[model samples]
Target: MDQIKLTMKELKAFIILWSTQSISTLGSSMTNFALIILSYQRYESALVTAMLSVCTYVPYVIMSIFAGAISDRWNKKYIMLASDSFAAFCTVFVWILLRNDRLEIWHLYALNALNGLMNTIQQPAADVTTSLLIPEKHYQKASGMRSFSNSLVNIVTPMIASTLLALTNIQTVILLDLITFVIAFLALLFFIKIPEIQKEKTTQETVLQSAKNGLKYMKQNRGILDLILFLAAINFTASMYNAALPAMILSKETGGEVALGVINMVTGISMLVGSIMVSLSPTPMSRVKVILNTLLLSMSTENFFLAFGNTLPIWCVGAVLGWIGIPIMNANMDVLFRSYIPLPMQGRIYSARNTLQFFTIPIGYFLGGVLVDRVFEPFMAIQPAQGVFVMFFGTGKGSGAAFLFFVLGVLGVVTCLVFRKDKNIRQLEQ
Candidate 1:
């Protein structure tokens, strides 16, 4: 494929797309945070909290394969519109139920499942469309702007959700989310004008043949294959971190709803900074290096802190300090990924990427829950009135098993090493 450059009009189109997504992303984030908090309050277990997550992600695994093939072959615009509208409609319906105080955990499970399915369609479609609308040279700029927008939204959304959860009902936030999707849908329908790519086809080809072609192409692209593997490792470590952090809070020493929200607020702030840096960087390659460095430091430090569970303030401070690495890594990859893939095949490749990346999340969540409960929590409970588990380093009691923090850091560093050694990855930077 020949490289194309963006026109002035196209840049405006990208802005419109970005604005619309910005609103919808806020709703999505609010709902996600609210539900997790609700589940946490009700269940007090990581597994149940993660079950909501599993419902959200598993559908992506199931839908991505077919969605990818269809993404390559379908009218991409309609795909975006349809998925966005479905998501918006679902938000409204769920809001109505929650507002009536009729919503249940199972309802969250089902609605999140629906959310996941819609995302399977929307994510790939928007990414593919970005490539189609913007030229290759501007992909990095587009990525920067997009990440910046995302960080801006994250910075506010969590803080907003926390305040909303405290001051008003969660139902109010859900209602606001409904309005955001409506605005986003209108922007795509009216403002963005991307020309569709129609691949020339053989008269006798079947859907099966086209699907085979994408898979075969993937098998041959060793560079992409390796990058995906390294990404998966990073994702797995993050998943483990996700499962453990919450358990660390309820570990009997440093516990509170406000503290959990505080950590997220910190994470969002750091991510905003990371996104700004990535957006302003001289090149995408430089941004990737920043991402790797931030992760290494954050993972190493956060674990060290999670190990220091003497008080809520101590754990809270540790939580905020350690969380900065996450958004940087996420923003870096979001830019890098969008820069590389073509519009048509994005769905399949992205879906495949999601499958590999998340395959370990369920395992990690379950393991973290069991380890904390059956292994870590019980042991720590006996060691001190506050400890959750005992280890040679000391005890994770009260704050000791925050030892899992160290474990997460170790896993992340190993994955980073794998990424560093790959020559094909170096080539991508160029």
Candidate 2:
């Protein structure tokens, strides 16, 4: 394969796009941290937090197929602009409710649903646009840039929000998010021009038919489909961890707002470290190898520490090591997926791929909450009933969540081992 090098113009365009998106992400992360704090203050239930996760993620599974199909048929720039605009509007509305002191739990859920829908549309469009603007040789680098931005947001947002909340309010944090969205949308409208992807078939197909075609395309691509299914399972386990982590930390004796901030700071820094490593290094010869190794190592290390480590310092180490693998794994896997899919089909196929990969996320989120609140917490509370779990995870408020994390980590390791045995997955790059 000949490497496609990006020209100066393309590089300039990517820089502008990346800068604007990073600004927006930073603002959004602040608001996300603020909301998590707000929801915990009001509900004080792990189940509620998990439900919020579901509200945020379920829309992708619901709308990504349609959004992907629409993106393929339209100018991706306009799709992104529209999505950003709607998200900004939603933020303003939420701010208004907060100002009036009339904000409710349902309001947050509704806003999350709307935001998720907009993101579902924007995500595929943005990713496909990145692929279009950059040369094939630069996908991993671009992914690294994305990872860095995400890490920056995660690293700073929690600390910022914690301080801001002490001094101001959620309304102020949301207002900042709105401002960032405006900057991003304006940048897209004036500074950047995403070239329209040219498809061989000029005649437009019906929306449903186009979506059906995307599904059909995947059906014929058995290797890709199988890989997607495997990812879906991985996502399910990952979601459980995501849902449980906050509860575990917040409920533990050693954890508080400060501890949470520290954990997030370390996690972000670790991810940034991984992203920088990938960005600075030459692209891997085998993306599949990079992907599997990182996934197995990160998941195993993270869960093991959370399960066995009792103190904040010990857990923080685990958090950092576990997070470091994510960006490396993701950057490589993204390159693999991008290389396999044709550009024109990327919108549809990427959407379809994401829809499947995240299909089990809602279930994981819901179950994480229910199991933690109803099953695990109670089961671990009884001293005599502690059994083998006490030996591994100890007995206390967070013990249940720790046990759950252990199981998920072990499952993630098993998943990587299972995938290694599959011929299609092993040869995906070839």
Candidate 3:
């Protein structure tokens, strides 16, 4: 009876945390969507747009290694609260700048970097808190809930921001974000209770040493290391596609922000369906196989359609198919990490994993931007009237990005196939 009661209490706490955090995430997503549209409108350069992501990720990748160790040592709740407060302040600052007409591309870049730094601290703390609050058996369900909220946010944020931009301005979208943040902040401060983790005090360890220990742990776990490396490769390719996507759609003669929003909404619905499926289904016998197979399916079909298809309907079809597998892949990956790593070490290990898996993203973003702006766009612009590239990708502004997507699709599939046969990765199933 006691164990059952404890389980119920923990589950309730997780639900509270999840709900509040999801609300906060929705706000953040709205601000991000609005900003992306704003940036693209002002500068009209893929590199400039991609730089925003680069700035955010550079700081995050740098800070995450140390932040994870700190999260393990500090009060997770306080860390989260502090991080959220700072992030809200950044949003407010952006609103102020816009109101004063002083906002510039560089300002957004700097603010995104600050937000990224805060997220490094907040993410590990939040991850640890969830691990502490939820039972091990419920990890997959919890992951699904997280994915559902994210997909819902993805669906709504684009619609909301685009509508608000049409009706009012970017300021209104930012204001709505602020309102949502306040609600989430108050709920987290007043309602959620995170259980304390008791740590064994055998010897004192420096932050550097703690961070290194995470690396050492991964070094020892060959399977986990291999998995992270494989993800790094995947992230690289995905980031390039993502960085180019906005420019691709906007540059098309028939495409615009509303078209992009519709595609995003369709993609989100597919992801929502996938999340629901994962939430209701039993744990798979081999998560490794599921991850690889889904990656194969998503990468091949989505990119193929997107690269070749010229119409919005075709783009929507690709978007939906591409996104459905993401939630399932993410849920299984979360379960794998939660199951394999010890609760106490999860913060550091997760941090380490983040560093390894995301390090390629900034590079990919930068290269994608440069390629689209300098290389591919110019090359496509000068292409002769008839060829395989022109026939498949269509000529003009968006064609370069289309060609890049095709390349990424081929590379993604090859990467998955090569990694699928790795002995270390297969061993994770055991």
- What candidate 2 gets wrong by more than 4 Å, as runs, is 1-9, 385-388
lDDT by residue (tens digit), candidate 2, 294-369: 8778877988898887788988899887889889988988888888888888888888887888989989999988
Best by TM-score: 3
* TM-score between candidate 2 and the true structure: 0.95
Maximum-lDDT candidate: 3
Q: TM-score for candidate 3, please give it.
A: 0.97
Instruction: Give TM per candidate.
Output: 0.86, 0.95, 0.97
Model 3, 265-338: lDDT tens digits are: 98889999999999988989999988888888888877777789999999998988888988999999899989
| lDDT of model number 2 | 0.84
Indicate whether candidate 2 or candidate 3 has the larger TM-score: 3
Structural RMSD, model 1: 4.2
Off by over 4 Å in 3: 1-10
Candidate 3, poorest ten consecutive residues by summed lDDT: 198-207
Model 2, residue 268: what's the lDDT? 94
Clash count of each predicted structure: 13, 0, 0
